[model samples]
Structures are given as structure tokens and as C-alpha cells.
Target: MTVALMWEARASDGRGEELLAWARAQEFPREPLRRETLRAPGDRVLVITWWDAPYDAELPELPEPDGELLTRAVHRWRFESVGDG
Candidate 1:
């Protein structure tokens, strides 16, 4: 199993395109987008995503946003198979 940690604050300007591009460059067993859940907090929101592999595993870049800048801090984890677990 793989685990990922993402933490960040949005930038003053949006980063839509940049983020999209970054997502497009990722390499994984399946779709890079994976899944995401967001929570709105007035003018800002929180994003959570799951990945097939850890962050240091090496992946593609993400797209940039055209709106307010978003800051993010991310971490990833990779776990052994169920049998191993």
C-alpha cells in the first residue's frame, strides 16, 4: 500500500493551469489524478489526495493555477502488500 501526505496554503494568485500541468506529468500504475476531497473554508479550501506510490518514488509535475496562489506541503508513504502487512 502507498500513502501520501499533502499540506499547503493557497497562493495569493490562483494556480489552476500550473496545477493541472503538474498532475498531467505524473507517472503511476493508474491515473495520476487518483482521488481528491476538499473542504471549503470561506475564501480558502483544503485538498486531500491519495497516490499509488510514495512521494520520493518520483512522479511528474503538476499544473499551475491561474487564480490565487496556493501553498502546499506534501508527504508520501509506501507500504508493503497485505500479505506482508
Candidate 2:
């Protein structure tokens, strides 16, 4: 099974592009099977990375960005494929 990690953040006032650029410039600890990035209307950025590992596997995560770049702390979630698609 594969697991997907979702990381999201909202930029501080007028810093959406800066936040996106910072995220784009980040390096993951390991290569993912698939990855995607999305942006929302409220200066929010979401990053999803799919990995070939068990749900409970220990994997490195993206380090938190500098506090000044965000309105609040980052949000993260993990999901495992159900294989019924």
C-alpha cells in the first residue's frame, strides 16, 4: 500500500507568493511516487506527496518554514490507499 502525506499552510498578509516559492524550493527527505501542489483563494498552499511505504512507516517530513512567513503553524495529515478505486 501507499501512503500520502499532506502538508498545508497559510501565508501571512501579502506573502502568498513568497510562501509558495519557499515551498517549491524545499527538498523532501526521500523521493515520492507522486507529488502535487495546490493554492487556494485565501493565500493557502497545500502539498501532497505519495510514498511507497506502509502506513506506519517512519518517513521524513518537510521542515516547518520560518515563522515570519506564515499566519499560523503548518497543518499536516496522512492517508493510506484503500485500494478500492
Candidate 1 residues 1-31, lDDT tens each? 4544343334333554454444434454555
**Which numbered prediction scores highest in lDDT against the true structure?**
2
Global Cα lDDT for candidate 2: 0.89
User: Which residue pairs show backbone clashes in model 2?
Assistant: none
TM-score of each: 0.39, 0.93
Which stretches in model 1 have alpha-carbon errors above 4 Å? 5-33, 67-85
Best by TM-score: 2
Q: Rate the local accuracy (lDDT) of all candidates.
A: 0.42, 0.89
